[model samples]
Target: MSAPFVKEIPTLLSLIQCADSLVKNPLTKESPFSVRVAWFDDAAKTQTALLTHYPRLVKESFYTEFEDTVQAGISLLNFQPFWSIMLGVETSQSSAAAESSATMPDSSPIVIPSVAGKDSPPEKSAIR
Candidate 1:
């Protein structure tokens, strides 16, 4: 897949951050599997690395889609100012890279991961 354009880098970065946060703290926490799957669909489209396998997208094909989408969070973390470094994306970053380590066909894909910063507001402020 081609690198994301420089113009879209910041938005991509934000998506990456949100993806990570969602994986750890999903808004879908109380939702059912169907809703979570729909959430994954929407989230994956916003970033390039996840969208790499778009042509293969099948409705309700959850496993491959999950791996590909979640891996995007880990994939681009290998390159910051990601649009620049990802132009020559490392081989390990591809979802296909997980194939070789497969214990069974399409079973347990491995991610070789190798990033930077974020901040959030405090709930309370100090009065001086």
Candidate 2:
């Protein structure tokens, strides 16, 4: 008799743990603003399916709390539950300047909207 196939999906907590490390560690020491993530799923078909569709589930599970934190202007890194699974990361002014110049052409300055006000001057901020 042939053995039945089995698949395993990592729990949300496991994914969160993995994500935590990615966020904590910068892609390069010189570029503390950048993070590297490998978007690969488990080898198992069923597990891969779950990971492929996990973004929605993650949002559904944490959207409310995420919204609250944003409204309060609190850093997601400080939020224990969502720290590892944060959609994005914050950047410092110096890091932003360095990254922008490195990635963009010098023809024109890139205009980024300010959170304080639409008319306010552009400033470095988190990329979420």
Candidate 3:
């Protein structure tokens, strides 16, 4: 028998794109947040890099309150304004297929992250 062939999952870049879209523009009424995932052979290094790269975010109330950083990351991604800079894009969209299947969705999920220097209350306050 011949060796089986398997297709590769989309690249991190593609994943980021997908995440950016969902974060940028939510579709369903209940599910609004987006997600980003990173894979690595070395889990420790990946965790280190994430913490090091976003120390402020990691230190903020939102991150501190959450038990899992992965969930924190997902929450952060939902923060509307900040998500834009992470991807350097105007707006984003979630995958239609994924949105349809989701359950236990977030109510009033973040649509636009608060912009810096704006009158909006800081996101940090939301956590408290």
Candidate 4:
């Protein structure tokens, strides 16, 4: 599959679910700008993310009108648990690692970990 990204899908999707943006993007062309927070541990192995953003540089999305033509060979509802776990990556893959079924929140509030790659933007401490 092509490595196409919807800008900041994970971050924007999460933030869109949360409260309003702390600082809206002034030149917001797409109307959606997000953050990639990083997760780190001191001596205690405690995870944390701090959201910060600044106009970096402009680049083109290879898939401005990307589409998925593949049909669902199977229903994913039964795989929700597994998908939850995969999406969680609770044990490894630092950035691609968070929001497990156990850690997934159901209201209240919680800090989200950064699961992006080392080179990618950090993860935002988000709540949904």
Worst 10 residues of 4 by lDDT: 65-74
lDDT of 4 at 109: 36
What is the C-alpha lDDT profile of model 1 across 26-112, one tens digit per residue?
433356767655544445443334354332333333434444554553343331254334433432344444443333333333332
lDDT of 2 at 115: 38
Per-model lDDT: 0.40, 0.34, 0.34, 0.25
Q: Which residue window of length 10 is worst by lDDT in model 2?
A: 36-45
Steric clash pairs (candidate 2) = none
Query: Model 3, residue 77: what's the lDDT?
Result: 49
Off by over 4 Å in 3: 1-6, 28-128
Off by over 4 Å in 1: 1-12, 26-34, 46-128
Q: Which portions of model 2 show Cα errors greater than 4 Å? A: 1-6, 29-53, 57-128
lDDT of 4 by residue, 1-128 (tens): 11122222235334332211221211122322232111111100111111211112112121111101000101212323443454345224434333233254344333445557679885654222
Report the C-alpha displacement of residue 59, candidate 2, in angstroms: 3.6
Q: Mark the 10 consecutive residues where model 3 has the least summed lDDT.
A: 1-10
Instruction: Encode model 2's per-residue lDDT on 61-124: one tens digit a residue.
Output: 3433333433232232233344333332222332344455556444443343333676778775
Which number leads on lDDT?
1
Say which prediction, candidate 1 or candidate 3, comes out ahead on lDDT: 1
lDDT at residue 93 of model 2 (Cα atoms): 31
